[model samples]
Each structure stands twice: as structure tokens, then as C-alpha cells.
Target: MCGVDQLRVGLVGGGPWARNVHGPGLAAHPATEITAVWTRRPEVAGELAAEFGGRACDRLDDLLDDVDVVAFAVPPQVQGPLAVRAAAAGRHLICEKPLAGSVEDARAVVTAVQRAGVHSSMVLTLRHSPAVREWLAGLPSAPAGPDTVASARWLSGALLGGPYSASSWRIEHGALLDLSPHVIDLLEAAVGPVASVGWAHHDEPDLWRYGLVHEGGARSTVTMSMRLPIDPTETEFAVFGPGTPHRLAGRTADASTCYAALLDELVAAVAGTGPTPALGVERGLRLQELIEQVRATAG
Candidate 1:
């Protein structure tokens, strides 16, 4: 457990997301502090630690010793083993989407966290946005039926020419791995659990389109691409039902703001003052399973 007033955080990864959102958000949040930093690149870790008020640790073990929890912004493959080690060390976890590169790895992390009895949360940033939360809250609480349907599209040029463009994992995996988790998660949260991927397709230039059947008989279709030429990225989510359609258009709050909200939940969980995070590691594992199903269907 963390200190009653503040949670000491060990941040893994010094990439753009880590530098811009995780590190800054933790430093700015009243209930948390970036107590230690570790990354594959020592200099990058040192830079982040210098800017975020944490010590640059040469090893992950050293960082774990200094912090009450671990927040990961690393790639999924790298994050998996490190998260397992951190959970084994009895620290709480704040993990990135998909939990890990593979479903098996994600499940391992889940098992480790459960064995340690540590709290865990996934970075489903949109769910933490006030606007997105309001939109979700307005939707009908009852399980969706066949008449309920949703459509979402997230088209971006993230892998074309941006800070994320250089990401090897994003390039290799495309938007299905990078963006589908958020879309699928939101759809399920708004409607019902995804029972299966009805159909899926992946075209050149990273376009992905898929249909899903929700367990409650509702359905959702998703279109995504990170290599599009579109400027300002187009994103929208709309659900249609018997009464009226609800929509959450464009981006929600900035990553920093959403991350702050996530921090609030994590802090509360760590202090035993709140329920376990709704978007936790087990949730990540489930998303991974759904994503894998989509991939298989696409092929």
C-alpha cells in the first residue's frame, strides 16, 4: 500500500507519451509523485527524471524499490515482463492499453497482479474524460438489445508524420493494435460486451474495418487507420437506439487531463478508499482477446 497522502510512482519508459502525459500528469497530481524513472535509454530516463522530479534509476529493480507503484508507458512487449516483475514485487500497476503484446502475456500480468493482490488500472484515456463519461452516463443502463447499434471511426495520420510515426510497433501492427482497444472498449461500455467479431478487414495503408456483435444482441462497427492523410484526425462515436441517438464527436479532453482523472482513481484504489478501477488489467486482457479475434477474422 502507498502512503496515505501520496502515492510514490516509478515510471517506466521515457517516450513521447511518457514525457508529455504520464510524467507530467503524475507530477501535477496532488496525490502522486514520480519517485523513480527507468527506461531502456539511460539518457532518456535521466532527462525525464530531471524534468519530472524523480531519480534516474539504472535498473528496474532499483526503481521498484523506491516506489509504491509502477506506471508503464513502454511498448506492449516490453511492458509485459516488466509489469510481471513489478507485480511480483508487490507494487500496484498503471498499464497502457492492450496490457501486453500478446493475449498470453497480458494474462500473465493479470495472474501476477492477482497473486500479489495489487491494484491495477489500464490507460483507457477516453473513459476518464468528463465529456466521454457524461456521454456514456446518458446512455440507457439496461443491457442493449438487437435494436441498439453503434458506429465509430478513428482516422489519423499518426504513423505518417508525427511523434508516433517512428514507433516500430505501431508501424508493424497498424491501428488495429494501437487504436482498436479504445474504440472497442468504449463501444462495449456504451452497449454491451462484444460477443464476437462478425467480420473484419485490413487494407493497405493500415485501414481496418470490423463489425462486432455485443453479448446483449447489440452491434457495433468500427473503422480505423493511423496512416491516413486526413488532417486533424477524424473521430466520432454514435449509438442509435429506439429513442434517440447519442454522439461523442471528435476528441475528448487532452491526454494530460484524462490521465489526471485516471490518477485520481488509482490513488483512491491504492489508499483503499475507492472501488477497484473499472478499466483494470483484467479489462486489458479481455480487450486483448477481443482484438485477437478481430485479427483472426480479418485474416
Candidate 2:
């Protein structure tokens, strides 16, 4: 955007999501210049800092003072307070999705950004994908009958728990907030607003699973457990677009080079040119609300 000049970034999560998505994505942006990174673990922070040749700050506040934007990649539970502080400090926020663990906290984060008169964003980078872009551009009028969605299911398996910690506060009662939101967002994009829904959750000490029913006869079933034997990774949204069963592929796939194109769109957003997506913090919060509704009934 704006001819892609250097824009400073302060990353606030150095773990897998950060390392895999945020760090690489920002580094590759034509207009972005990462200045610092923050993580609770000094070893991880310092290691990335050295690799990137940037400073490693222990506290998020300190990093705030050092960069133009903050990419929040921390766990879902730790995001609210950090977002509150970052927004108050007047830095643009690039938050990871599932915006917050719950709708209430997501609202609070949005409120903070508004109160501070700052620009903030939640990174659902998938929305910027090429397939998603073209597909969304020509999305047919909403279908008028029963719809079935096959989506990503990851939980209680090596996918979510083996390497990742169960210590995170992603779910208290259900996996709807953490796992289902992605699917719901995709479904909403393909279909219309979900007017009402029903759900069932299979909760374990470290796992949560569910089946969802949406208005307009759309239904989806998913499982998010920390005790899986395999890592379930597949995200695809299919709907009869223009009567041809249009599909833009799924989230578990990156063959479309979505992240790279997404960064370009972000640049476009900053430039005030082309549509990079107008989704703001508020939209994410709204989605979180829908997620909570489905999650609350997990039993």
C-alpha cells in the first residue's frame, strides 16, 4: 500500500502460529519492517529476534513503544488484556482469529480499540485467499434448500494436543469458540446469516467435540479434542454457487498461496486502493458471539 514503504511491526507471539504465520507473513510484506518481537520465553523471543535481527522485548508494553503495529499471536486467553493495552497505546493491532476466547472479551477488545481511536485488525488471513477472493466475488445468491458442510476437525489428537499445551484457556465448556468459528465464518460467507442453531458437545478432560445445525437447513459436525491419534487438518467450503457446486478449497490447504496474496491485500488496504477486505475488529467480535451461542450448548 502507498507504494509499499517500510512499516514497522512489533510481534507479540513467537510460538508456532507466530513463527509459521505472523513472522513469515510480515517479513515477506513489501511494506512491512518488523522491529521487535515479544514472547514469555526469552529463549524463543531472543532466538527469533536474532534471526530477524530485531530486538526482543519481554513485556508487550515495551514492544508497543518500539513499533508502528502490533501483531498479536499470543494464546486466546491472554489476548484481551494485551489488546486492551495495545489499543490504548494507539497502535494498530493485527490479532489472530477466534478473536478472543469469548464474545464478551472480544467486545471489550473492540471497545478498547474504538476508545483509543486506533486502527485494529483481526487476522483471518484465509479470507484474503485467491480462491476465496474470486469465489467471494462471484458468490451466487444464497441457496434455498438443505446444505451440508464438511469441515476441519482437530482436537483430542496429535493435531491440537500432542505438541501444543492443554494449559491454554481456549475452551472452558466447548471447542466451538476455538475450532467451530473458522467453519462458521466460512459458512456465513457462503450462506446468509445463521438465524438459529442447535448443537451437541462431547467434552473430555482435554477435548471438546460438537455437531452444529444452522438456519436454512445447513448442518455441520466437528470434533476438537486434545487426544487424537491423528491431526485433522482440512478446511473446505462448498456451496452450489451459480448452480455448479463452487468450492474455493479449504483452510487446511495453502496451495493457493493465500497468505502472500493476503499480505498484498493488507498493503492495498493501507493504500486506500483495491478491496483488501473491510473486516474490522467489530466483525470478528460479531462472529465470536455466534460462536459462543453454539459453544454454550456443548454438553
Candidate 3:
């Protein structure tokens, strides 16, 4: 439980995404405050703390003692153990996707959170994306009508050269492992739970494709890559089955807005007044299973 006015959040990880997205996003959220920051790098933590009106904490345990909630921006491997520690402390969690480096680690997080009864929210951007939300709301509940099949592509040049190029995990894991959590989560939301993986492949270095069978008999294809040397990028999520096709079009709100919405949902879930559907550590475990299956198939 948090204070009536706002939640005091202790931020972890001072990476590029944390600096650019998470730092500003928490600052901009009216109901949350970054009360403390802890990063592996002391100087980077200090910089973020100064920029976000938080205290720089050298020890994660000290930061945990000071906050009502913990928000993680680190890689999955780092996120797991720290999240378990936070859960044991009865602190709520806002975590990055993929939950952990391995399925076993991810399951540990889920178990800890469930045992502690703390609210947990995974940072699945599309779960909070306005455009995606609109598209999802417009979808058929049962995937029974025409044009119900869906497909998505998240091709990006993140590894070619950009701020994210420095991300070692993203570079090593490739697109399917790095980016497919959001894609799979979104597709499952639009259709139903993924009944099984129809097929998956590492198309080439950095490129991957997957076929998914939804619980409702609807099917989807997802393709992604971070190695493509493209000027801009290519991304789309559209559905087509029996009727007219529906493509995710129109101007989408920026990531900050989506992050803010995620915080809002986290607040609601913590308050026990909102739906917790597919946005927690449990969902992260499910995504990890999907990733493992893909990896095994790829290998």
C-alpha cells in the first residue's frame, strides 16, 4: 500500500532507456515520485537522481527501505533478483519485459511476488499504447468473425547504430527475445492466450519469425530484427480474417505517455480496483516460456 497522495518509487538501473524514458516518465507522472535511485554505476545514478529529484543510493537495500514501490529499468538478468528482493520487502514492482534472463529466474520473480502479495506490473509498452489499445478494443472478443487473423512486424535498426546499440543483452538476444514480449503480449490480448507456437525461426543473423496459434483458433505471424540497416524502421500490427482488414494506423502517442499510463494501471492494480490482466510477473513468466520455445526451435 502507498501513501494517499503519491507512491514513493525507488528506481533501479541507469541505462540509456532508464535515463531517457523511465527517468522522465516517472518525473512526469503526478501520482508517483522517484524518491531514490540505485544503479551499478554510482555516477550515473547520481546524475539520474539529481535530474529526477531523488536521492542517489549506493546500496539497493537502503533504497528499498525508503520506497513504497520499486521500478526497474535494468536488463532482465538484473531485474529478476532485485525484483525478488523488493517483493520480499513487500514493495510493489514495475519491471521491464522478459522478466529475467532465464525461465527459471522469471518464475522465481513471479513466485516471490505472489507469495508477498505485492502488486507487480511488467513494462509492456503496447499494453499501454493508445493506438494499440484502440485497435484491441475494436477487436472481436472471440476471434470468430471474418478478418480475425492478425500479423505484426517489429523490424528495427537498433543494433546497426543508435542509443540502444550499446545494449549488450539486446545485441546478444536478437529481436525475438528482446522485443517479442510486447508483440506476443499484444497479440494474445487481441486474440487470446497463445495456445502453442506453430513455428519459429531465426531467419538470419538478427532476424526472426514466429507463428502462433491463439487459444481462440485465430493465428498470427510475428517477424522482428534489430540488425537491419534501415533509415527509419518498419513496424506494424494489423488483423485480417473474414471481413475488411484493420491496420494500426494514425498518430500514436509517444512512449512517455504510454509509460505514464502503465503507472496509472499499476496504481489501480495496487488499489485493487482495476483489472490485472496480463501485465504482471506472471505474464512475464508466460512470455519467457514463449521465448524459450523460440530459442530451442531456433537452435
Candidate 4:
């Protein structure tokens, strides 16, 4: 890797997300190449390989043998075990989030990455959105003088009917597990760590809410759903404290743009000059722990 000019990447999973975002993003990056692709369906892998300028491989090991890193767009359950195998084979990782469906599975991914001493990143794309970044940076150190109350409301019709309608995991888990992590991670970043879940609730028809007590005494509320039927309002994060409220607008770019930035981070991390920060596997595990806490409290 010392004198390598391009990082060869093995892309796993050929779902809509892989085809739309991961494939396009990796293909667009100049510092890396999608050198191989392997999926549960060989035809799908072959299609993506042809479209993205990579070779299709019949086996994971064959793909592994041809690349320096592996980027996964598989479901949470599949992503977990495969990630472990990839890390064990000494491949760097670009994993999608809610790293695994269960805490135990998520922990295994963390251990594998650590033992392999590989650079890894989780696709927490919101952290790379320019609009989101501007808002985060504009906030003061104590963000509204130590008495901040933040709230995020993300309403969507993804489960009701959209590109994600076919996602079985999202259908089974619903909004809490699938969508809450995105909102929670952003809220936690803007405020502080979620020290405790004061209250959490999910009613029928896709309404979910949480009262999160952040460290340093700041409090935050999160509400999200994939069943909202109306034309959704802009996803907003608002904070109110000693002064006028401050709000951060959601991303303006498409998903591919967001993922491209994430890929850039992965490239830099592999190059040994970038810090993975909140996008790393450990942060992903912590998010999984938070998800379990919210679930336990909601139940």
C-alpha cells in the first residue's frame, strides 16, 4: 500500500442501495477503483461489475484476492458476518450502518476489525452532508449556553411505498431500528452522548419518539416514521435554549453525493492520513447499544 496510487475495492451486495449509491460512488472516486464485485446473485454481481468497471467473481475469496478493501451494501444481518470474514482476511472495510441487527453481532464486527488491525468506516452519511455540517459547526461550544433542548423529526413514506418498500428488515424492524440511528447519531453529535433514555414510545401507524438526556445536562427529543402519508416537511433539527432557536436543515444533495464523501473518508483512512471518528466501527457498535437501550425502554 505504500506506493499504491489506487486502492482496489471489492463491492459486496447488489441491492438497490449498492446499485444506486455504493456502485456509483466508488466508481466516481479517483483514488480508488471498484476492482471486483460479489453478491448473493452472480448475475447481479456481473451486471454491477460490467456497469461499474470491475470483474464479477463467483466467490467472496476470489473478490478478496483482487482488492485492498471491501465495501458492503448488504442487509444488516448479512453485512455483519461477511464483514467479520473480510476483516479476518485483512481487508479494510466500508460498512453500512446499524452495523448489525443485534448488539452481539455488532460486537463481533468490532472485535474482528480490531484483531485484524484494519481501517474501517461505517456509512453514517448524514455526518458528511454539507448543510448538516454547517449547522453543526455554527453552534457554540456549549450550544445555547448549557441549557439546550434539541429535537429531530424525520417523517418519510419509505415503508409505506418507495424504493425501500422491498427492504424486509426495515419492514420487520420498522422505524425505531432502521431510521432512529440516523437521527440519534446526528442529535448526539450536535448535543452530546445520549447518557440515558428518559422516555421512549412507538404507537401504531409509524410514530416513534424518545426523550434523550444527553451528557452535560442537555436534553434532546427524536421523532421519526416511514408511514407518514403527507408531503413531508424538510427534515429539521432544532435547538432552543437561552436565546432564539437555532435550526439545521437536512441534506440538499442526493444519496450518492453523501456516499461519495463517505468513500473519500474511507480512501483517506486506508491511506493512513485520516481519522475515522464517529464513522468508525466502534461508534457503530455504540449506536447499536443505544438502539437496544431505546428498544428495552420502549418495551
The number of the candidate with the highest TM-score is 1
Quote the positional error of residue 106 for candidate 1 in Å.
0.4
User: In terms of TM-score, how similar is model 4 to the real structure?
Assistant: 0.95
Clash pairs, candidate 1, are none
In the predicted model 3, the residue pairs found to clash are 146-242, 146-243, 147-240, 147-241, 147-242, 147-243, 148-241
Task: Report each candidate's C-alpha RMSD, comma-separated, in the order given.
Answer: 1.1, 3.8, 1.9, 1.9
Can you write out model 2's per-residue Cα lDDT over 50-156, one digit (the tens) per residue? 76646899777788888777888887768877888888887777777777766788889999978986666666655666657677667655433464443334544
Q: How far in Å is the alpha carbon of 179 misplaced in model 3?
A: 1.2
Clashes per candidate (backbone, < 3 Å)? 0, 11, 7, 0
The ten-residue window of minimal lDDT in model 3 covers 139-148
- lDDT per residue for candidate 1 within 1-299, as digits (tens), equals 34568889999998899988998999999899888999989999999999998899999999999999999999999999899999999999999986898999999999999999999999999899999999999999746999998999999999999899998889899999999889988999999888889999999889999999998899899999998898899999999998889999987868988999999898888888999998999999999999999999998
Over the full model, what C-alpha lDDT does candidate 2 score relative to the true structure?
A: 0.65
Candidate 3 lDDT tens digits, 1-299:
34566789999998887988889988888788889999998999899999997899989999999998899999888999999999999999999988998999999999999899888888888778888888888877754433368898887788988888888888788787778897888788877888888888886668898888887788899888989886567778888876567788433547888898988888777667787635889999999998788778667
For model 4, residues 166-213, the per-residue Cα lDDT tens digits are 998988888887777788888887888888899989887778888988
Cα-based TM-score, every candidate: 0.98, 0.80, 0.94, 0.95
Worst 10 residues of 2 by lDDT: 150-159
Candidate achieving higher TM-score, 2 or 4: 4
Output the worst ten-in-a-row residue range by lDDT, candidate 4: 138-147
Between 3 and 4, whose TM-score is larger?
4
lDDT of each: 0.92, 0.65, 0.84, 0.84
